[model samples]
Target: MIDSSAFQGKKAIYYTLGCKLNFSETSTFGKMLADMGVVTAEKGERADICLINTCSVTEVADHKCRQAIHKMAREHPGAFIIVTGCYAQLETEKVSKIAGVDLVLGSNEKADLIQYLNDAFIHRAEGTTLHAFHAVKTKDIKRFQPSCSKGNRTRYFLKVQDGCNYFCTYCTIPYARGLSRSPSIASLVAQAEEAAAEGGKEIVLTGVNIGDFGTTTHERFIDLVKALDGVEGIKRFRISSLEPDLIDDELIEYCAGSRAFMPHFHIPLQSGSDMVLKLMHRRYDSALFARKIALIKRLMPDAFIGVDVMVGSRGERPEFFEACYRFLDGLPVTQLHVFPYSERPGTSALTIPYVVDEKEKKLRSKRLLAMSEEKTHAFYEQYIGTERPVLFEKAHRGKAMHGFTDNYIRVELPPSLARDAYDNEIMSIRLGGFNHDGTALKAELT
Candidate 1:
């Protein structure tokens, strides 16, 4: 049994890696600890507990997780360490052997972290080591733990769904996160209401496969959108990544005229070559993706569209890559998130005979990245003289305050006007040319 008094006044530090979903989960965990009277540790201070949320989207990500764990262990000596997230779910044994790790929790098990921490503290007080592991098999991961929390930024992330049913050939997400699952629509709306009550102005819907929401409940994604649109006090809402085939006409039409939904969309076009997409076992083809982009442009011309493109997967011949580049060049997307493919163990991708060399993969990624910059710059230039509603965030380094427009353009105000008074406040501002650093567009009061 845990001593209830043991948790009071304890200091804890959290380190999170990977997607916005992980950040939301970490935030929720922080609240849980806070309720027990544990406070966040200050920078460079040793804490009584250390929690690390990890990601394993790629081999490089796995290496980073390992490095972060080692660094945390060294910095907070004698603190009870807990590791969880996708990396821990897939590599329980490997994470368990890490020198300072006291416990390993899987995707599902992470929801019950408070109880595990209590047990760990009990064992520690008795002069016993508590290196425990708890993980549910992928197929058996059914519980959906809802999370709605703010990051260091102004916008809050609401996890509307979790897990994925479509296991792409080169992906390990389904293995690490489990099948599609989500809580009821009423539950999600309640969470959104709570966020609004807390003075949140923006909320971004996050999930492993959000468009595939309503797997557990009989609700549809469009229905959920309509319900959230009725939420008051939230000035903005942005839909994260959606599958191409799932961006139905109804959803697109609704967002174009919705009260709070912003004019921004992130759709993954893993590859522009239909042949390569087929090898990856992606449900939709390149033509379908192109049509979706065209429809979005037709409905909301000024909307910012972001595309995720992975280069150099197995069997992506030179001609296939050339075709992909051409297809992307013809699209009207605002930005391209380019990544070089990384092979993972136990994936069907290894059975494919062809493989792009490292040099070629890097070259391909570089080309796409250059194209992405050009596309984004042109998109930003188009609205140079226009006025848009921008929600400014807190200033950093006491320097400049940055914010995003309704269409997702990053804008910066001069340090002179970047006052604390403007933080989290939405104002009409005339967009100007690039700032001194060229990282964001300069803005002036309208």
Candidate 2:
């Protein structure tokens, strides 16, 4: 029903909120618009259409979404505003009432936004709302087809999986993203091969619950990695955030043996206390989480291990906090992503008793963050005076170039090294010493 002629050269701007998955989806949407002859422009610049991909993981995300819509409306009043993603899907009534939100599309209907816009402009209506709330049926949800070209990225995000099956007590992803689904092994391999052929040095396999991958397919996460290992041109592959319960010995061992996969694992621990884990409805206890970390250490001793922890959750006492600190202090983790607990609407944790005081939450967050710094510095110290493979990215912050070593240490190279290695090209570099901040390593081309 869309008359494509009306939008031939209209400029479009997109803003993304939330995780890597959201970014990947936004990039895919951008490519679609480009194919339709829509020019992509910088945010805050004049454009005919403004697309805001929103996140509703927390109340703060909701506030930011409203702020973005208002700001964009003020900058370009006549531009059509389209709101989509988890926040729009879950809080349709509230989002629709926002002053500048001209159209609201749910997750499934997001792909059809351009066509809807074309139709709306041709017909000249006040506005339109296409809220497709039906749970994305397995067939209705297209297997993540790579719509964009791969040569653009030194590292490409291949969405091998989608949706979450686990309904964590403090999470709403299950309701917002629907059930777990993944493409067939053949489809995933084809996509990875395309990225490899396009000169992508690393392919980060991302998803809502990547560990929950293969629930729909007979193939498991390890199986997918093994399949990708055979793909040529891709120097490395990385797994995004995964649940502690799914970090098995087999996957760790496979990563250890594989040349293509990087020696890094990002697992979310959420909480260290067994009581808190139970309250959060997490699948693994502290013991199991500890064992998983141990297995990764045993297989790949120098592997960069990242942990995700939430501070100030319901029923977390001082003893519980100390338990978390002690566990992390003794672990071989490279870094920690600490988050202060924030209430989200429709989540059970929001209504739970024993909420920590706001001041106490800030105190606990600071303590954990300090511990995280200590752990990160210790991890980076291990790679000093060693030669490791680094995938150099574009130069930034003056003449310095930055990249990540195989062990996931951030390395800074002088501008000279920047020319030989294109963005995402893997090369060997010898680490000189740690910077004063302890966050990165100073390195020279070997």
Candidate 3:
């Protein structure tokens, strides 16, 4: 049992890096601690405990995690620091030697974090700062960790699935997260019910390679989507970052007809050249990605289709880059998420030949990013003078409040209004003009 003396009146703060899935899991941990009477530390208040949920998707992310840990160590010198997630799973030894980290939990161990922490606290010498690591490599995974993120976010994210089976040559997630696994349909529906009851307005389903949803029990993702639609009180639901090949006709059509599902799709198309696609071990080609975008536009003409593209993966010669550019330019996509490829340790990408120089990679990335800006401006122009329902967030940046529309447009509210009244409320706003170099929409209350 946990020593109530150690936790009863303690304050904890969490900082997360990486994807929405990480945020949801960290939030779940926060709720778990709160139930045990450990309150979150207030703003400008020093915390007794610090939790840093980490990511190691790229080399830069790993560097950022290390930098953040050292900064947290200095900022919260007396706090017991705990580290978890992908980076912890991969680099437990390095993290253990860090100045302030007292506990480290990996992917499998994190699923049982509460019990592990309790046991650790019981065995530890009183007032001693000792470091411990718990990282269990995933093997034949059968259970799904349930998670939800609220309060700090406008949309509640429900982690419907976890892990990845597709070992794309350039990707390290499959090894870090393990083979794909998902919670049963009934369990997720129940979570949706709880979220709806707790005043959650929008629920976005998130996962690592969510398209690879049911590897264990053979349940379909569509089944979960259909079940969630019937959940009462929630106004909207969104599927986050699905794979291009997995965006089937039935699934797209179901989302098109469903009232709750939003008209926005974020699909990963790492490369547009079929040659580079094969080299990267990606399952789908440029043509397949184009077809998926075409299908979404055919059904919902005003749909916002987001694409994720990698800039400088191995074997992306100048010709290949040109081909990729042409393919993306020809597509009816709205926005582009351009990532510069960084080599991860022990991946198939390391063995690939003809690595692009760092300077060349940056050049390619700049071009794609500039193209992204132009495309985004054109996308925003279409919505100008039109009206859309925007779901506003709780916090304000200085004098302005921010939010997003159903079609994934960023919106802002005037400083004159009562900010508290609009927080977490969806209001009809006329899209007026662009701000921040076409990155945000200026809105008028309707």
Candidate 4:
């Protein structure tokens, strides 16, 4: 319901923070504005409006949200700034206090942004008044429904689920995101098919917790993948991040055989010590997590496995940290995402004893990062001289094209294979060697 007459040809810039869910929502918002005859512009360019989709996962994220607002305001003083997402939902007062933010919308009120902007513009034209929608309770607002697949990407992130149910002592996601919810299987398949037809080679299923997908009728995650595997045109499918407990043998078996599914898994293991996991309120222990990895290896030995680890957390001493290092070193994971603990307000972890010192935290982080590099190199070395299917995306930085193998290995193509046809096209690439960062593989067309 944007006022087309007041700003018929105005341009808008969108900045998204946090996960793939935020990106998907921002894209939807962009499309909605486009339908209202508003043009889209890249960030830092002159635009009439600036929209920020924010995150509140860590204190650093909060700082980034403020920095983005200040930076954008400095660049374009006349533009109207609108803020939405988890940060706005939980910290509305803090966000509203920022210098150039004109309107602050909660997570649930995001769908009404277009209408709100129209009203604001109409009032401004009449010189009547100015208003702001801040501190709107998320529970009172209706859900902003997701749209169909109208936009396209070479690798599309289809958000089939939202929110979380687990109340981890060290997390605030449950409060910010609410309970778990998922789209229907019929709707998901329709979206996937549209993305496939739109030249999307891979569809990455993303959510707060994708493993907890179906809540409607107890439908399993594998059931959803089975439906997506039948969709035509999409040559590959991947999952974002899943909980260790949710990954069962059945899901592993399905991905092992499915031609469309990619051989990759990213599971978060916040702490490798069972005692520390208990304090963090994680459901599964390290033993169970290791078993899950073993099962995956048994099915697909060459699978690209990624694990998340917290470098420093409550109740983690030197001995506990050693246990974590030993556990991960023995695993066949391709890489590790190491996060140093950053305390958030209202989380039980903030009150725990034996909090790691900043110096020690950095040391632990560096150690784990070195382990990640070694593990990644070893994994890539195993794939030397192997030929895998690579979907080359647009060429960038002077005739170099980049793509990925089915197992999520980053493949770079030489100038010979990097023709214009490589854009949004899938081709076979030979895994010739590894770059300095073993996560990336130097490839030639096979």
Relative to the true structure, candidate 2 reaches a TM of 0.92
Give lDDT tens digits, candidate 4, residues 154-195.
577788887788888877776676667787888889988888
Tens-digit lDDT track for model 3 on 16-104? 99998999999999988887779999988888888899999999999899898898889888787889988998887788788888889
Count clashing residue pairs per candidate. 0, 0, 0, 0
Q: lDDT-based ranking, best first?
A: 1, 3, 4, 2
The model with the greater TM-score, 3 or 4, is 3
Across residues 8-119, which tens digit of lDDT does each residue of candidate 2 receive? Answer: 7989888889987887777777777777788886645798888888888877898898888888778877787888778887877678778777787766677676776776
The number of the candidate with the highest lDDT is: 1
Off by over 4 Å in 4: 42-44, 128-131, 134-144, 147-153, 216-218, 397-399, 415-417, 436-439
Q: How far off is residue 225 in model 2, in Å?
A: 1.2
Ten contiguous residues minimizing lDDT sum, candidate 2: 130-139
lDDT of 1 by residue, 173-274 (tens): 999999999998899899999999998999999998999999888789999999999999998999988999889999999999999999999999999999
Order of the predicted models by TM-score, top scorer first: 1, 3, 4, 2
TM-score of each: 0.99, 0.92, 0.97, 0.94
RMSD of model 4 against the true structure? 2.1
Local distance difference test, per candidate? 0.92, 0.79, 0.86, 0.82
Best by TM-score: 1
For candidate 1, the per-residue lDDT at 298 reads: 96
lDDT of 2 at 148: 24
What's the lDDT of the predicted structure labeled candidate 2?
0.79
